[model samples]
Target chain A: MFAAQAFASLFSSPAKTSSPSLASDHPTGGQAAHHAKPLFFTTPHHLKLTYFPIRGLAEDIRLILEESGIAYESENISFHDWHEGGIKQQRAADNPFGQMPILYVNKGEFILSQSKAIIRFIARSTGLDGGDAYSAARCDQLAEGIADLRRQYATLAYDKEFAAKVGDFINKTLVNSFTTIERVYDQNKTRYLLSQDRVSYADIMLFELVDQILALGQDARSVVAKFDRIGEVYKSIAARPRIAAYLASSRRVVAINGASASVGAFKA
Target chain B: MSGDGKYHVHYFAGRGLGEIARIALSEAGVEFEDHRFESLPADLKATTKFGQVPLLVTPAGDRINQSTAILRFIGATHGLSGKTALENAEIDQVIEGVNDIRAKYRALPADAANEERIKFFSTVLPQWLGYFEAILKKTGSGFYVGSNVTIADLYVYVSFDSVINKTADAQPIDAFPLVKAHLEAIAARPRIAAWIAKRPVSQW
Candidate 1:
């Protein structure tokens, strides 16, 4: 089935110049000669990411690019750049959401102010889309869970009763979330959430959650130690070769808490 | 705020709907005009868009509305959206879910919303959390959508951290394993680590 799909994909796409048969037979004599390069090859996939100087949201796309092995230029501009230049201004004018993280592809820009949209796009290009509809939905559903977690945390983080609310949130909503996740881990026979094999973006996301919990202040470890499965998964992904290497590489990082208080502004 | 090139996001300084767009630019590595209003923007009342302040302006001076549309446009052109149709759809669905819950939270004021919020967080959220946990139960794989990272994961992590780490009246973190494990994974990312380290310090 996979082979048949691959063959179909090959034939469906325009012939490439690299194919000797097509190159020899066309001789500027047929439709093949008119359009030999693959449709995707017809245009370059250069991307320009527009956001604040901080990594408040774009990190996921960066991770996907690194994982996919696609080399795209990263144009780090400042807020001043947008005010000083009209292109950035016009780009946002075109934005329905009137936000940053507008991506310029081949000089033709497609804007997605939501962080998940951008990350998912990058993941798909990297062949990260999972096997079936259910699996894919599961991945999305997990992502939703993460979003919920962030919203809850954001509210509590800002409340004057930080200690009280944050602690309550951790004990109530967060704990329940983890327990439910633990149940999921058990259901999949202690493998991943979608299936028994193959890692997904959600897996990496889960790893991030655990790390954040552990590293959050001092008592975080104590809070996290309660969930054995979470701890186990954290150790597992942290140990993965690609992820480990990615983590080690300097390209994997940008500003984090420098704009932590800017959570309310994130459309990512 | 008076200039055509100026963009104003009216939300509180904390991470919210605007941060994703802000982060996307950082990842793609471009800068934009930004105005963070501690209080509502003084010119908000005069702005053309209906009372809200989270507005973006173009060089041509066009105004945009809705957060999802903006993110989609940014993701598509910048390669931040997923690689395939399925991945994109999945990301969309997850964002939809996030919206669903965020709407729930938005409906209520901080004090008045606590009870309803608690019920939704403890009950409704768990159901969704369970669904994700099932995905994580898959063998060997660590991600939500596919083997590689996706925006879905980032949003999820951001959302999770918002609840567990940021909120003062937020719920506990011990209840959901899928949620717990997933959070752990996202936090471990180096870029995310950098994000955490560089997060700004504010009174809120």
Candidate 2:
């Protein structure tokens, strides 16, 4: 395990350093050598991370790079950036769905939609996938579970008519949903799921869900408090080294400085 | 971009339909394009098969629709789909089961009666959950369908998350213990955890 971590770090250092001039560098020998040397490498040379400047949905993949210790530059384009008629025209020419977080690779470019797919791909490549394929599958399952929970939240919370339907969805579907997770946590004797051995992508995703619930001021902690196992699971993930740093970093949150936002406003 | 290494995916924000494919592509460490539209342009609108988004355009100009179809293709290329024919079938079954449930849950009309939600919650939801429970139980491991992560597992989680989170009511978290536990196991991953933290809390 230590050896693998060491090797990953060794490769990551060069990979990040090599891509310093990536935006203007194009696919030259330096970048090609870096991409080619990896035992395994993801496609998409240039990934235009499209998202509302706010942390709407691109955070998962961003966190993947942080956790994997992969260094990459983030192009935080806001709604304003795309509002320009020319920008939209450019996007029409370049993009298929006309979305953001698109990765541009060496051979050409591969379009990836959906956060889970992007996050899972990053996890598998970074050695962050659970120890084995079975565990990895488990990790993917958990992420999907979180996505389900979030969808429910969106329907009631985001919709304009949230008052009418919020209660049932929250009380029945959302709240009732936690029981399924709690049971698994209780049955498993390990500190983490998949035998409580090592941290996996699933753990990170779960923690985020719980945290988001709390951040919404919804008292998600009190809801899950009954399940001791679930609590422990999230605690373990929150304590991860890289994750802790990210949460502590100023750049960790959305970059809301006026310079960027003003530029974004004008661009839009 | 190099022709041999190019791939592309299309979808909107908010983790709708396209999330599963994104996870699969990332897990495989394969690079691809993530083409996005900002509020559905007219020209791109004409290109969409159904005028809905999430169309994957390959370098060879192969444009594909349906989020699952894109996932299966990427899974095939990355060796994440399955090792055998039988395994792939099982994976497909799991995906189908998940999709069936999602359709039922999402189709809940705006004017749906409490009984409708109740029926889904008690009868259909449990039955679907039980099916997954049985499959995972047989493996003596946490994953479903096959010995590895396939499009099935990804689809299930997304479906489960969507149903649980998108609903307009609240219920006890203990009702679906196995499903919840499965979710926790996946959430505990480092990369995934990071992904979650970085995502907007309200959106998740």
Candidate 3:
């Protein structure tokens, strides 16, 4: 654990250090030597992240890029613009799933799509994947659960009877959805999902989801507070200087989703 | 670890999320116990951290949920994943691409005559399939990632197989020649074909 923490710090605040061989950095190397090659991204790599004109699936990604001080621009595409011969449509044939939130890496050398893929890529490129393959696998597992939670939130938000059904969803369904997260936190006894002092992809993703839930005001806040460890993760992540600044900056995405009739935090 | 030890994979009898991991283990020629259930028993469910299926009880006795996580573990140790973070991301994007279509395809009302389903089979499904077809063309490697077969290929093959017949035309695969051929190619691999033939029969 000590070595893992030290490995994490080397990448968390990346320096222009010489590359370390995979075998030297990872004592448990060979099998995962390929997967564990950490890219020390002292400079921005994800040049542009394009998504719908809402937080939707891109907020966690935005959080990572900002916290790492990686320079990138966000391009928001409206539904109309996507269908109106815009850049999104132009890139559709190449875009994975022909969807928004595609990343333009290093000035479009590689155009990567899919939110989860982008999140992991940014986490890896910026050293947030928990330092080794095992911890990285655990981080991936927790992040998958958060993706499921986000999907549930989206499903309810887009429900035809959202106005009538949202109260029940916020009060009951979401609380149940969070049980595994709370359990993971309890079992780890860490301030963050994977580490006590370091932030991982899961922490960023959970923070993004919690931010939306908290934005729903007192009731939502109280429900989240019910999971004390989750609250700690949220506070610790939001307190990071860059993350804090990003949240306070004009670029903070206020909408939890795209144009849904009654999405809790969709600003419109 | 190089996945030298045995493992136990738990899931429903049906070939859903669990099938991918099963296919991966079989492909890697790793020995493991395959536990299937009609539904997760309460006792078994209690042991799962999330009360979910497709849990892989590891060689180390760790209970891992999330099909992706299990696949990642297998992939990393079994030479079925990419060589670098970038390569893995590229591989993962393909799976996420399949997932994106699967979610939308699942949400369509089940009525065979529904107009939305009609539009989906004719437009949406084809649209998504074309993206994959183009991916194959771009890679031109006969595999989703790298020169060798990865979990990305298996994932796309399994996911598309389950949903491609939803409305016949609604989930069309014929027009995308590369995707259609890719599916057939994957289905015909000796080990994969043996597993497919011997695996349990399920509607889904």
The DockQ leader among the candidates is 3
Indicate the residue-level lDDT of A138 in model 1. 47
DockQ of each: 0.03, 0.03, 0.36
* Candidate 2 off by > 4 Å: A1-48, A83-89, A92-95, A106-111, A163-169, A195-197, A254-268, B1-204
Worst 10 residues of 1 chain B by lDDT: B58-67
How many steric clashes does model 2 contain? 112
Question: What DockQ does candidate 1 score?
Answer: 0.03
- The deviation in Å at residue B18 for candidate 3 is 0.8
All candidates' chain B TM-scores are 0.72, 0.82, 0.93
lDDT of 3: 0.76
Residue B15 local lDDT, model 1:
63
Q: What share of the true interface contacts does candidate 1 keep?
A: 0.04
RMSD (Cα, Å) of model 3:
6.2
Q: lDDT of each prediction vs. the true structure?
A: 0.53, 0.55, 0.76
CAPRI-wise, candidate 2 is incorrect
In model 2, how large is the Cα lDDT of residue A102? 45
Which CAPRI category fits model 3?
A: acceptable
